[model samples]
Each structure stands twice: as C-alpha cells, then as structure tokens.
Target: MGRVRTTNKGLPRGLTIKDGRYYHVTTVAPRKWTPLGRDRSQALLAWAKLEGSEPDPSIKTFEVVSLRYEREVIPTKARRTQSDNLKELERLRAVFGRVMIEAIKPHHVRAYLDKRGQQAKARANREKALLSHIINKAREWGYTDAPNPCQGVKGFKEAGRDRYVSDSEFRAVWEKADQTLRDAMDLALLTGQRPADVLKIQRADLHDGALWIVQNKTGAKRAIEVTGELAALIERINARPRERLSAWLIQDDCGKPLGTFAMRSRFDKARTLAEVDFQFRDIRAKAATDTGDLAHSQKLLGHRNREMTEHYVRARIGERVQPLR
Candidate 1:
C-alpha cells in the first residue's frame, strides 16, 4: 500500500495504485466534480515529467469552463479556419487563473459574453462560437453528459459588408505594389483564387494561353483564359528568371515559398499606402462576385454549386466601382 496523498483543499491528491494495472485519479476534467480514474496516466504524467514542473496536480486543474472549451476542443474541428484560438485560450486561462473547468457555471460564460460584446460584434461572436465549439466537443468526447450550453446564446449581431476592396483601391494597390507583391496580387485577382492557390501555382499550370487547374479549396477543375492584360503580366513574369517549377514562383529574394502570413505584412503596408484596408481574400470575393460576368466569374471562382457561389457573391461581395474623385 502506497501513501494516500492529499491536496491543499485536503481532497486526496490524484491517487495512484501501483498494482499490475495502474490506477490514477484526476480532477482535471472540466465540470467533473469527482476525480477521473485512469489506468494509463501518460498524458497527466507527461505534464509532470516535463522539465520545470511542480509535484502538485493543481497546476493542471480546469476551473474556467470557457478555458476548457478552448483547450479541449477548437483544434480538433474547424482546422481550416485561421485563428489564434490557443492564444485566446491562454488569455482566458490567465483571467480564470487555475480554476477548475467543471466548477464553472453559465454565469462565467455570460460574463465573458458580456465583456466580449463590449469589444466588437465579431469579438462577441468569436467568443460565443468558441464556447459552442468547446461545448460540442465536450459532448462529442463524453466530457459532458448534456449538450453544449452555448448552442443558442445570442451575444451580438454583425453589422456586415462594409469591407469590400473597391476597384480603384485594387488598381491603386496594384500600381503601388513592388514587383514581388504585384505578381502575388495579380495571381489572386485574375484567377479569382484563394491566397494559398495563388501562391502555390506551378509553372506547368500556365499553358495554351490559359491558366488551367483544379482548385484546392473546392477541388473543382476549371480553366480561365489569360486575357491580354493577364497574359502581359505572365509574359513579364516569364521574362524574369524565376525559381524552378519545384519551387513557388512568388518567392522572396532567397526563393523560399511565400506563406500567406509572411506576405500579410506587405498587404498591410501596401493597402495602407494605397488607402485600402480590406483583406486580400476580399479581392478574390470581389472578382468572384462580378455580376456582369456571372458564368465566367463562377468558373474562375470554382464554385461547384451556384447557390453557394450566389450566397458568397450576394452577401460578401460588391461591385468594385472606381471611387468618385
């Protein structure tokens, strides 16, 4: 028989049986009042075993319910969306400060919702959505018996659709951009493609006076003819000695592949200089939503279903008319 250890709260510390089948107790599970029993303690053990650790299990307790939502869930689903979910989670953890997850109530979530609403509508929605994701994940993973409490909570409403990059803004951005940024922006605009698609384009894909391909975002196969302007852009690019087909065409001086993140600094500076604050993706959406060339724009956008494309156009995009002087 081993010594039965206890916590500061005098609760028996996560107990361990040194029997042939190992049994360990934990209070780390959010909203779980009783300690969890595990035969395989590798996960909790790893945390302890890592360098610069404490002997007490209280270091790992989850009291902040929203923190539990972030840590236990967000990364698993919606992996495609770009967000600093973990960073935001750390902020939550700091605010909650070693509180147990299962110990938290809806009031904690409500406080977060109220504070988030004061910041911005998007901020409120992000917190709420993250909470919903956590709750759903908990239910999915058997952490919670009930469905997520965040399912129907209305935190705030988005005002929406003032974010479009107008035509003059695009032209100004294009004119202001250096060669590297220009080529990068051109691929995004002309192809009506995602930033990743534009950056990852292979030289082999440009042939027959057309930019042909299967789009990675939708997996749709489509082709768009390179008109004289776009063709001229290609000709000038080809005239330069670019990195090999194995490497990305739109690379830095060192020929490293241009990550979307790495180029965003350029986007920020150039858009500011050009006096446009919209995101690069807004350019793609604008191209996709061109009402005059609906069929052609849809093909370029690689929208499999017209309804999906129509919604993206109708709601998210606007005609990029030149700004009135």
Candidate 2:
C-alpha cells in the first residue's frame, strides 16, 4: 500500500503510506522523493522527513549549470560580443571542472576574475559582466536557490585606454604596412570600421561613390559614401597585381580571406613599425568620440545604444580635462 499524501500545517510535509512505502515532501523546492521499495524506501522517506528539505547540491553543480547554459542560452540569442564571453566560460570549465555552485564562494570567483582581468582590461571586464549574467540566469532556471555569486565579487577596475592615432603614427603605419594590410588599415581609419569588419569587404561591395556591406561582426548593414581619399586608396589597390581572390578591397597576398588573427598580426606589426600605441579599434573609437553628437556617433559605429559607443569615445576623446575626485 502507498502512503497517504496530505498538506500538513500548510507546509508540505513528508508522508508515510499505510503500506511499507513512504513519500518525502519538499515544500520549498516542492520536488517528490519517490524511492522504490517497501521497508527500505519507507525508511529513507522517514529519514528525509527527519532531515527536512533536499540535501545541498554536490560540487559538480557548477559544471552542470554551465553546460545547461551553453546548450540552451548562449547559441540562440547571444550577440557577437556576448558569444565571445561564452567562449571564456568554456575556458573556465576546463580548469575548474566539477566545482559545486555553492562551493564556489566569493573569493574563488574574485580570484579567477583578478587573474584574467590583469591580461586585457576590456576583455576581462566583459567576462566579469558575462559571468554575472550567466549566474543570474542559472538561478532563474531553478538550478540554484541562492543569489548570484558574482554579485559579491569586485569586478576588474578598468584603466583608461588611448584610442587616438596621431598623424605621424598613421603615416608611419601606412608607409611600412604590406599592400593588403595597408588597404585594410586605410579602410579601418577611413570608414571607422572594426578590423573584423574591414577584412570581410568584397569587391562587389564597392559601388559608385560609396561602399556597401553588412558589418559581419555586428550584422549591421551600412553604405558609407566613398570619399576621395577612400577612392584613391581603392584605385591604388586596383593597380596592384590581381590575386584571384573572392574577397573585397583587402585580401591576403594569395587572395585568401584574412582572418581576425592574421589581420591583427599585420596591424600590430605595422603599429610597432610606426611606434604607435593605438590598436585598430582605437580608430573607430576616436572617430566616433571626437564627433559632436553622441547619437550620431553611435549610429556610425553600428552600436544600438549611445552608451556603448560613448564609452569608446570616452576612452579616447572624453572630457579628460574635467576634474574628478
């Protein structure tokens, strides 16, 4: 015979059937404890009643939640930048595999954040933010009943970065860069495009007086007017030996599409030769930041919000002269 189940004192309580069977009731979590057997199951049920509530999660909870998130959340709706953060989560699971969620206290998260933040201020800051989002979502998914662990940790404090490429730096880079890289660098500065975006430009994207392309990095479609400077650069490249490449204005010497790392390597070497401290992204930031209107700058940068572009601007050309405590 099975135990008779009932709500005791308005709190769901563990009930023992008239038979040797038992049903453990967890009111808070409201999950069932159904173990198969007669006397043995009943004995376990009795023990559960005496203990009250489910046992704490095991150490493997962290890996479990992370797996669920990557499968269910990260792929479907995450943007490009958000996807980058998810990659970081993949990295964390590799080293700290099988850690329990609750077992991970504030100190553990802080230590991880501190170690990574020291490498790249901007990228680390993004991971810190992404970690918070993931943990909060975990709670909502009923994985953990506690608050987000990242909530208690201090995130990476960012130092201001310089984004402006001085005229001398620009000249030096242009003179020293290889043909493909020089075109890319010119396009990056001219259109204020991200390096990832610049490398994807195809010949077909060029039109009368303008370039038309969808920013692959952000999926933002744009048609920027080709100024005389940009046109001149395109003409210069057109005169070069044609590498039967399928990509737009910029391509590898063999005409293979330039990947992000390759493009960056080229740019870094060029910056070094030019003695410039600025990265390719600083061009976009400086162009957007130095402009008069924040709203216009955001649109040009293909950012959805003013705040996103504003920070880049601030990093490069913000009111640094203003006094702050």
Candidate 3:
C-alpha cells in the first residue's frame, strides 16, 4: 500500500506542505525532501518541472541548476567565499528560481541588477558575478544552450576602501587588546597577511629563517624572511605559556588556535575601548602604505601584480614633492 497522505490536502502528488512551506518528496527509497518555496504558485511551477514526463526536467530550471552548483561547486571554494556564495545564491533564487534557464535574457539580468543595486551596489555586483558563473556552469553542464545573460550587463561602479589606521589609532587599539589579540595584530602587521592566514600560522611554518605562508584566498605562497622585529615577535609567541601545548603560533589561554570569529570579537571589543573607527582590515592597508616602496609592498602582500598593491596603498598616502632648489 502506498503512503497515505493525510496532510497537504489539495496539493499535487509528491508535494507536501510543511510549516507553511512546500517540499517535494522523492519517489525513491530513502526519500529526500527538497524545498520548493514559500509561495504556492511558485512551488506548483517547480513541482510541475519535477513531475514532468521529460527525464529530469528539473535541470532545465534555474533553481535546480543552482542547487547542483551549491552542492558540487561551493564546497571547493575558500571558506569565506563559500559563505558569500551561499548568501548570493539565496538572493538569486528569489528572483530566478522558477524561470527556465534558457529563457533568461540580458534584460532580466539587467533588471535584477537595477533593482538590487538600489539596496547595495557592491553586493549587487557580487551577486551578478555569481549569477554569471552559475549560468556559465549551466551551459557547460548542458542544462542550457543559451548564451549567458549576465554578460555585457554592466554592474554599478564601486569605490575601493581607503581607510588607513594611523600610528596613534593603532597604538590605542593595541593598548586595549589582550596578549592573544596583540599577537594576532602584530602578526597581521608584520607579515601583512590576512586574519585567517595569521591565525593559521604554525611553528612548523617557520623554517630557514623565514615564515612560510600559503594564502587561503589566492593559494599564493610566500616565505617572509624572519629578521628584526618579525623574528623577535615569533620568538616571543613561541615562549608564551598556555594550559595546553599546540603547534599554532596564535592561541588563546587554552592553547587552541584562535578562529576568525574569536579574533574579530576580541578586535571589536578593543576597537570600542580605543574609540577608533578604523577596521581590523585597515591594518593591511596601513602596512602597505607605511612600507613606502611599491616593489617592497607588492612583494610583502604577495600580490600577483603591482597594480593591486598600488591600489591597497593608494589614496591613503600623500604624494611627496620636492621644491625648486
């Protein structure tokens, strides 16, 4: 005897209403529940595609392709990027979920950008980029033969962040920060690495009088020569006592490695105490600007091109001129 449907009366076969949301129940053993949507009409459209005579007709819809992308592609990205992609996917689904992948055109994409840009221009640009990638993958996977609609649809212009933390501002935060937070900040400033990378540093990464770094975002590798203040800082961190021994350079009182969230929380508290407006990330810009050499800053930041390094240090530093002798 087939499973009796008591609830979800008047809904289509294989679709059930749960907590005021529609879910599609798979026919196979160990059935999976796929969320259709909150809107009844949209859920019905998705149900039709799933139950259609065409084999796996769901692949033809933007929602299904996005699901596949989320499952297969998202996990391979950096942790931060994966988080951002999921948020972008949520926004994209609200707009394009029920639409046929092939039916999407440039105008639809532009319209999305125009509406979403009103709220957050930078975020809209990021979402459009994610959409373009999704469409490209859909084409490659044979879900759609139409050209990517996001192409040539211009995104809103965005300005780069130019906030620079001054020496006094940096000192104020440093004074308020605890020892662990101070170590993290020092590592960030000295190596010019990102918060994630700085927190992941291990004693093993230090060898041959250099601190080796494999950047999480770009996968770029750098071996920063250990000398002067950097060398002393590493020694001090290693000498610090903890309840437990860990290989990680940056650690809390318990000796467990500090994650980004903990680091940010500590930084926020310190920032509040210092009464400074500059962000933790601004320290990177400060490092680049203080270096005062384009080539040196480029190398220190491990940028693929000098242009990127220049952008980091630009607008924060004033031009130096010489008066007529």
- Which candidate achieves the best TM-score against the true structure? 3
Compared to the true structure, candidate 2 yields what TM-score? 0.66
lDDT of 2 by residue, 33-128 (tens): 654344332344344456664434343366566655554566554256545755677566654545766566667777887787778766766766
| Stretches of candidate 3 exceeding 4 Å from the true structure | 1-58, 322-325
**What's the C-alpha lDDT at position 80 in model 1?**
42
lDDT of 3 by residue, 190-299 (tens): 88888888889998999998999999999999999999999999889878878987989999989889998898999999999999988777887788888889899999
- TM for every model, in the order presented, reads 0.63, 0.66, 0.81
Q: Write the per-residue lDDT of candidate 1 for residues 1-325, one digit (tens) a residue.
A: 6554442221224433343332334445652232233322232343233323433433333333443343344434333442456445544555454554344456777777788677666866775665566555545645556645564566776665545567788888878776778888887877788887788776788778787777655667767788877788777776676454344567765566677777887888888888877888887887776545667766678776677666677676543568789
**Each candidate: RMSD:** 10.1, 14.7, 6.8
Better of 1 and 3 by lDDT: 3
What range of 10 consecutive residues in model 1 has the weakest lDDT sum?
Answer: 31-40
